[model samples]
Target chain A: MHQAIAILDSGVGGLTVAKEVMRQLPQEEIVYFGDTGRAPYGPRAPDEVLKFTEQIVEYLLQFQPKMIVIACNTATAIALKHVRSQVNIPVVGVIQPGSRAAIKATKTGMIGVIGTENTVTSGAYPRALQELNPDTSVVSLACPALVPLVEKRLYRSDMARTVVSQSLQPLLNSPIDCLILGCTHYPFLAQMIAETVGPRVSIISSADETAREISTLLHHRGQLETSGKVPVHRFFCSGDPETFQAIALEWLGEQIKVSPVFWQMTRLSR
Target chain B: MHQAIAILDSGVGGLTVAKEVMRQLPQEEIVYFGDTGRAPYGPRAPDEVLKFTEQIVEYLLQFQPKMIVIACNTATAIALKHVRSQVNIPVVGVIQPGSRAAIKATKTGMIGVIGTENTVTSGAYPRALQELNPDTSVVSLACPALVPLVEKRLYRSDMARTVVSQSLQPLLNSPIDCLILGCTHYPFLAQMIAETVGPRVSIISSADETAREISTLLHHRGQLETSGKVPVHRFFCSGDPETFQAIALEWLGEQIKVSPVFWQMTRLSR
Candidate 1:
């Protein structure tokens, strides 16, 4: 079986990026693994995220995917470097892709990054942005509540908007012209953030940039799926499969069938 | 710090019960811990739920509560027995309280139980109800999607209502005069369920019964707060405090300030 591109995240947040990949690469089959069992990797220690990321990647490798996308900001922050080294396939994280997109889009060299606490604290985006443009100034904020708020489908609620406004106030105060949603889940709340920051700030979801990166990596490696076979995306979670499927349908629409893969940790070998 | 009643659940579904406790015992202070970080304990292995429940209990003990309420059906199904023996403070799980209430309300001696897959699979309620009255007939249905539906706040959505109605159709075929919302989170979806089941079947929330049990246990143990103290209700989560607080206000209302506790693992163990 030809392994498709494998995308892994701590939870449903990665679906935003996965959806983007599907839209861009309709011919490429995808396998998505969401570690919904132990999610919100934002608050966990970096070591734990590394451990969790490794487990999921190893699980996905059984499918022999051509590439892997670490579609979580927290994992990208702490585990991407280690993960890339461990996996035989090329592993891409969203942070650098998003940072590059923001740097290119920002005219004033003022960029903003918003994600979970762990992602912001890691200074992953600022470092990546600075690497691209040393003179660029980056403002990063941790919108911890935004993910759950989106999970609750409270994006349109005034209360949710108010909370987003309050959380993004500091970032809005800066002279940033481009705001990077450092976390894949953050894009779900992009409308609220965009509304709060006004129209001047361009909101860039890492999901889009990551998809582009996947396409680029696959193209460069000459590993793009060319069989013209109909793509089927498979989803698995360590938590509730039915629940994960329901949320996936809601976020990705009802057209797709996201099945649950019950993952059991058999053995962890380095 | 004066100790208050501490209630722990897998997620915000327990807020329905916490709100009732607040309403019934206005003078008593309440502290809530929702493992929104890792919720929907229904399908998880019994041992996993038990471990998570104990961890939360241990965390809540730092507040030095006189008693603990396991406001989660999955937790109650497996952990209550072990939890009771482990804690010096009386620990009351929702299952027995809910079962007793359903048995009392059912004039037809026919009862219905709706919970997560694991909860129903455990046959805990069937055994408990039978122990109370061998003549009583019980119908149990595993609502795997109910938690996610509740989490998304789509209780009233046509899709959610349709799912609930379909899942409950089997129980509707029975002669149950009273239906137990076996999972604490199920109560939030109560209004939709009540409407679906119509006016015939009485719907009982484990949260309410658990609150009542807490009141009774407190009185019996001489731990009930009698100073008419308008206690400050504090909220904590292992995940995002902002998301937890947002859901708290959404479900229970914005009348109270939901504050975040800095989560330090070592600090929690104290």
Candidate 2:
């Protein structure tokens, strides 16, 4: 499709997913929105997370995107089905793709999931994994401390490792051969997590699988972009542009301009 | 560059590298040659490996490639420097890229390497890792049995896990935070390896890093192909095309035509 693929997260965490999309589908343009102002939607109620997601999706509709990717686990957990019903185009959420990847990776049917409190409490991953294979045994942990560590840029610190170590003890005690990084923010702490968990567990991220799914869906629909033109990606954040740009550059491995996006309730009325 | 990037391996194992190159650089044409007739260069003499790598390099030169990648770890260990001196084009090898990735992934400064006998014996990974960081400790294992399993298409059986478990016992006993799948074929057995080693150890494969290095080199040299057309990849094997093509299709995730390449002794006379 000539139209861009729109993706949004609560904050810069979704850049992990965006980075994979760019690497796997270089020809397709991306319109990304990060609601950093009201980020860490992890602590919010489902109704508020859904409302925020709707606002961003509404804002993203101006790009005339062919697909929408709910890149944040919390947003995907609470808002995915609601947004899918509201949108005319394909709307993909992170949980299903992550669950599918874990299913494919695990030799044992036991899987561990760690995400924000909202995502874990909602039981999204366990439901998704069990639905895919009823025999799958899932251990879910709510890592409420991680998102703040990542957002504060303290992921590499000793304190972060201590937090990760303490949080993963229950799952580590289990027989999980695969662990899903349920939050988009969690991948930033992958090294620490892997170190704490040891060598036996395969860490599964939704970014690569989500990108592959998008490519497959686009190809099946004959909407795969075939033009030779270089794709220009646009980034927007409802918070400090400089902060967003810095994190985006660090995570995506490229320097790109970030523009500020303010929500206008009147725009939705139109 | 308009010309293709040439890659050669002792056998079908290098298809892993070829697969990554295709995924990451879709617009760049590839000329791949698999020296399957004299396959399993792992146990061969260093001088013999050098001679064979030179012959393949000479053969690939006829394609007018802009860069050459020594996709086999054994060939890289024995002949990379010699091959680089002989060719004017940039030559990339698997060992350095894989070592760099391992160094980046390891948290304990303890790394493990699993490869063919020649690769492990060459002490290439230890040298590379130590050169990058002197404090880094490396545990090298020669998993000579694994390549045969992959080549024989027996990688998915229970026997494969048994083989992997037996092979990785020493590394599992160590404090390694990362394990390098030094041979390209090793990635095919990654699931089993991960299960044997457990979840704490990160698996590092050179394919993705090698592709990135190729991209960086091409970009730096102003040789990156910016054409929007789908690049066609050519495959040649010095042995049975049917066997190589089946493995290539399975490993590369695409249907491709494999051409038989006979070693003409008289061609070297020119």
Tell me how candidate 2 scores on lDDT: 0.83
Question: What TM-score, computed on C-alpha atoms, does each candidate reach?
Answer: 0.49, 0.53
Question: How many angstroms is residue B236 displaced in model 2 relative to the true structure, after the best TM-score fit?
Answer: 0.7
User: Candidate 2, residue A31: CA error in Å?
Assistant: 36
Candidate 1: TM-score?
A: 0.49
List model 1 lDDT by residue over A1-270, tens digit each. 566888899888899988776655556788898877677788888888898898888888988888888999899899988987786777888886787557545678888888999998999888776644456788888888887775555666789878988998787668889899888887777888888899999998888777765654454345756566677778877766766777777778755555555435334322
Q: Give the per-residue lDDT digits (tens) of candidate 2, residues A32-150.
A: 99888777899998988999899999989999999999999999999988998898998888887788667656778899999999999999999877654566899999999998887
Q: Candidate 2: where are CA atoms >4 Å away?
A: A1-270, B265-270
lDDT of 2 by residue, B35-118 (tens): 877778889889888988999899899999999999999999999889988988889888877776675456688899999999
Best by TM-score: 2
| Poorest lDDT segment (10 consecutive residues) of candidate 2 chain A | A261-270
Interface RMSD of 1: 27.8
